[model samples]
Target: MLNLTLSTSSYFILGSYVHIGSLKYLYFMLTAMLYIVIFIVNISLIVVICMNRSLHEPMYLFLCSLFVNELYGSTGLFPFLLVQILSDIHTVSAPLCFLQIFCVYTYVNIEICNLAVMSYDRYLAIYCPLQYNTLMTFNKAVIFIAVIWFYSFVKFLITLSLNIRLTFCGNVINSVICHNYLVVKLACSDTRVNNIYGLFGTVLSILVPLLPIIFSYMEIFKVCFSGCKQTRQKAVSTCTPHLASLLNFSFGCCFEIIQSRFDMTSVPRLLRIILSLYFAIIQPLLNPIMFGLQMSKIRNTCKRVFCYKMLTRHKDTM
Candidate 1:
């Protein structure tokens, strides 16, 4: 379950063993289907945003970026895991393994910054609605997003460079995804500096985004609660999803980073498996649903996209 914790040794979940049983096979099929469904939904969102002028605002632009991020982020690991789980061979080469690590970590780091930036944008929109359009201009948003990608690239490069200095004499990783802590642990060299920097990095990455989210909601609550009945209802309806996502995603990060420093052997492997699935897979999958499902326009756009082809086919048959 927690076998993904190893770093330096090549491993295969032998078919004769726990890796390829009936239950595991079912899990693979389900995960693949889930990934396909979510990817399609995110793609539909991209198409809708691209074609619709009404969604040309900064908020919608941010949403489009999010759809792309999730699509790529999930794409990097999900399919590979699916194939590995199904195939007899579970081993990956050194270069491909490193690349997979880079892709998964980089996109996730970008997502962290994007969420923070989006939260800031929301703060301005709700807290300073009259000046939001001027403050979060189209050009400014474009710059912010560009910076996000640049920052992610630089961060991953630094982290990967540090890891590469150490030799992986053995080829072992315990999880489906090459988890960050496992990578650090697998390094044949000392990771003292890396460990210290990692601590600071974790705090900065999690807290920087979360602090603003906390304050943003504080202000939102103050403003929304102070309003009259109808206004309060309207504000609550709008803010609920953002607040829930902020809490859930922030909690996932905290648990992942903070607890990873402890001894893995002490914890039950089943528990660790639960945590990994929750933090890595489920949290990213939920973001679009949490934010986008509430929007009437997006749902309608999705319905039209799906039905358009079917309707045309039916008309031709008639």
Candidate 2:
């Protein structure tokens, strides 16, 4: 039996990396390009929302929070990925690994909470249009955003504290990134506390956001079915991108959870790697593109901003 206990100076070996030899360069370039695109698109949308007074509504404010999170989550993963792809060894220090775990867990929590809040905002807009302004004021929206972020951080800070107390029997993590569950599994010390809290945390994470999301959508559907054609169209247009994003993120997260908790040695290694990366990479890229194209207000504002920049550049050249 492996009896080594993890210490502050210890490092973890990431065991999922396949040595692709010269192909590592190709992988590195693609990852770098993907990271760059995710950064630019998410940042552009955030800038647009912040600069436009017309977009100061609750929906846009929620969206700005979402985009900022995309940047936060992507930054946590992509830089580490880029370095690992180019390096000969696949290891990360204990502190860095735990930091990644904190970033990732908090990002997921904030994302689901943000989406749930957005759904409630949509519900107010559609169901109680008369009172929407008063019900979801700018101040209220700001407070919701603040609470979602703050709550997620505190919740995961406790989780990290629990995991930090564990003395690991092994220092090898079977995934490309530092995963909390996988790290806990390596503990030589008693992890009953960690496991119990983990189960409670998971339930809270899903239920807190999920219950509101379900209620909001149920109310929305009720209004849509009985209301005018305009009401149905409004719901369809606004909810489609959100629904798509939610489903996409959910699927990615589900696959990751399943992969982490179960034995999946039968699955192809390449496919496993891709699926593991889906949530972090695809969701961030997808949210900006989907929201940018589907929302007319954002689209038109982007066009105006682009045209103004071009016109100013042309005058400077002249």
Candidate 3:
């Protein structure tokens, strides 16, 4: 049904704005508030982790990296979404759309990798305590972080390269977010190559990281079950935050991917939009809250920082 044509340039209509009819300003304000909260929470967590020397262990470093990735991912979407809400037109330039796709998807890839690494860190701490310091040293953490970012870039580049070269039949994406499959759907040319490569990238970017996390948790559970009550409680405390994050992100990803891949005309437009924006809005906002509130070390450091600032202000006023 899509007509293929040669055009100098094209813009995409974000058809996901249908639910935001008369409440544009209200929507913008609320989303802006959400974005601000996300920024504050993630930044606060990162600062808390970074400033505490005792908390510079592998788990905390990975948490900091996770927080940073959340900021990166949410930043890719929130500002743009706010602007789009204010404007009557819901179109984006070709280049900007592609850029968003790159930023957002790369954020996701890095998130999966970061969480995987965090699980591995916990595993090393619990199961291989003697080697935790030696194996997961500061330099090794940096290397893992580097690999997370680098692999995300390389995988997304390959997929985007395939997408950019395609001739598009139309410029409308029926979703709130930009991703490779949506763009490929608009292509006038055969997309078998893109689809194949996209699948490969998905497996590499998501499943590869997930495999390690699952294995680490399994090993962790085995050790916990065989240990004393204190050991079991410690393991539960350490894994609870990571598992919560994994579930939140996993659900968001599954919703978005399913929406993109299947016919969702039967679903309500508003609900679909919410589901699509879940990763951008909810996961980023939730990660810091989960980790900061639940992880005792980060929580105590945050309280100390807050108390210190408050006392400093009170003394100055007195």
- Candidate 2, residues 117-181, lDDT tens digits: the string is 99999999999999999999999999999999999999988887887777877888999999999
Best-to-worst ranking by lDDT? 2, 3, 1
Per-residue lDDT of candidate 3, residues 210-311 (tens digit): 788989999999989898898888899888988988888889989998888899889988798898778778889888998888888888888899999999
Sort the candidates on TM-score, descending order. Answer: 2, 3, 1
Using TM-score as the measure, the top candidate is: 2
TM-score of each model, in listed order: 0.84, 0.97, 0.94
Which 10-residue window in model 1 sums to the lowest lDDT? 9-18
Residue-level lDDT of model 1, residues 34-116, one tens digit each, is: 88877977787888988987778787787788788888888887887787777666666555566677787777777777777
Better candidate by lDDT, 1 or 3: 3
* C-alpha lDDT of all candidate models, in order: 0.70, 0.93, 0.85
RMSD per candidate (Å) reads 4.9, 2.9, 3.2
Q: How big is the RMSD of model 2?
A: 2.9
Kindly give the number of clashing pairs for every candidate.
Answer: 13, 0, 0
Candidate 2 TM-score, C-alpha based: 0.97
Whole-structure CA lDDT of model 2: 0.93
Q: Which residue runs of candidate 1 sit more than 4 Å off their true CA positions?
A: 1-17, 254-271, 304-310
